[model samples]
Target: MIEQLQAFTDSLPPAVQWIVVIGLGVIPFVESYSGSVIGVLAGLPFFVAVPAAILGNVASMLFAVFAAHRLRGVVRGDRSEAELSPRRAKLKQRFERFGVAGVALLGPLALPSQITSAATVSFGASRNAVILWQTVSIIVWGAGCGALAALGASAVT
Candidate 1:
């Protein structure tokens, strides 16, 4: 399976490679699955892949941050129904009560990356804060995954 995936990614053009990286970064499931695997499949050094995945993930976080900023008014409409649901409302309130650090640490574990981005924005978090925290989370998680992958690659070889 790994070899087949490697062959597939290897056949793609450089532009497609970047697209794949970006796409994988944006999609939560793909982000989780590809975070480590894509780098290994690309035959990149662990250092290269780790940073690339972190950068790609950060790129996606940037997109979410900007989108949340732009869509803030739309998401938080005049009516309560137009806004996030009651459950999301409760979660946002919790984050608001606890402050940025709680959201920064627990958000990734509890929600999809994009949802967490949106939640932070909706909860009136500063754009810079969201970007900073999300970047940190992405780097930490991506590095951990990359290290595991590199270890596995070494073991297999």
Candidate 2:
């Protein structure tokens, strides 16, 4: 799967490689970190890969957050308490224990920011707060992964 992802990324023109990374970054599991790493491994420069991945992840998360926020009331309206899954319950605990910043920052390690952001919003967190922290998380993760790729590339050369 990783080889396939790298191959697909490499098949793109260098001038628009970032676009491919952006599309990958928007996926839940792929996110900015993996997408940026794939971009770099596919021969994209750190400057192009990192920012594009972060932008894509952030854009998708923002959209999800806004949508969830808009529909929070309606979704929660008739839902029974018994419908909550163990995963949902865990996320709720994380929100209560860590608040928006902790959950947003650490969310990528456990789940996609898109999922976490939606869960956060559904749990009644402020939309503005989730966006702000999630942006920080995306940037940090993208940069970290990009740096790792640079180091790996250098080692190979």
Candidate 3:
């Protein structure tokens, strides 16, 4: 699948290939890291690829965070908290232990930024706080992974 995507991306006119990278970055599992790698491997300049990927991933994640925030507000009105399942209890424990910053920073290791950002908001965290931390996390992860991919790609060429 990745090979096919890369081939497809390579087929586009070079002037607009970064646009496809931005679109790929918006996908959940693909996100900025994979998107940047794809863009670079598809022969985009590193500068163009990484930033485009980060922009798309951040935009999508922001949407998820805002939607989750709105949904939480609507669903939480005047209701007592329901009992959590054992799975949810464990997740809650982790959330409490890690807090927003830790989760935002480390979440990409386990899940996509969209899921992490939304979960943080659903936990009643401040929306601005989640956005701030998630942005930081996205930038760091995207840049780090993109750099590594660039290095590896150069080594092979």
Name the candidate that leads on lDDT. Answer: 2
- TM-score computed on alpha carbons, candidate 1: 0.74
TM-score against native, each model: 0.74, 0.82, 0.86
Ranking by TM-score: 3, 2, 1
1 versus 2: better TM-score goes to: 2
- Backbone clashes in each candidate structure, one number apiece? 0, 0, 0
Q: Candidate 3 residues 1-157, lDDT tens each?
A: 6456667767888657867888988999899988888788777778989999999999999999999999988987766546566886688788989999999999999999999999989877899999999999888988888899889888876
CA lDDT scores, all candidates in order:
0.69, 0.88, 0.87
Off by over 4 Å in 3: 1-11, 80-90
Estimate, for each residue in 3-86, the C-alpha lDDT of model 1 and write its tens digit: 777677778775666555656666774453366567766655666566666666677778888998889878566656446778
lDDT tens readout by residue for model 2, 2-100: 456567767877757867889988999999999888878877779998988998999999999999998998768878767889998876776789999
What local lDDT score does residue 151 receive in model 3, on the 0 to 100 scale?
Answer: 91
Which stretches of candidate 2 lie above 4 Å from their native place? 1-12, 77-93
Residue ranges of candidate 1 with Cα displaced over 4 Å: 7-19, 74-89
Candidates arranged by lDDT, highest first: 2, 3, 1
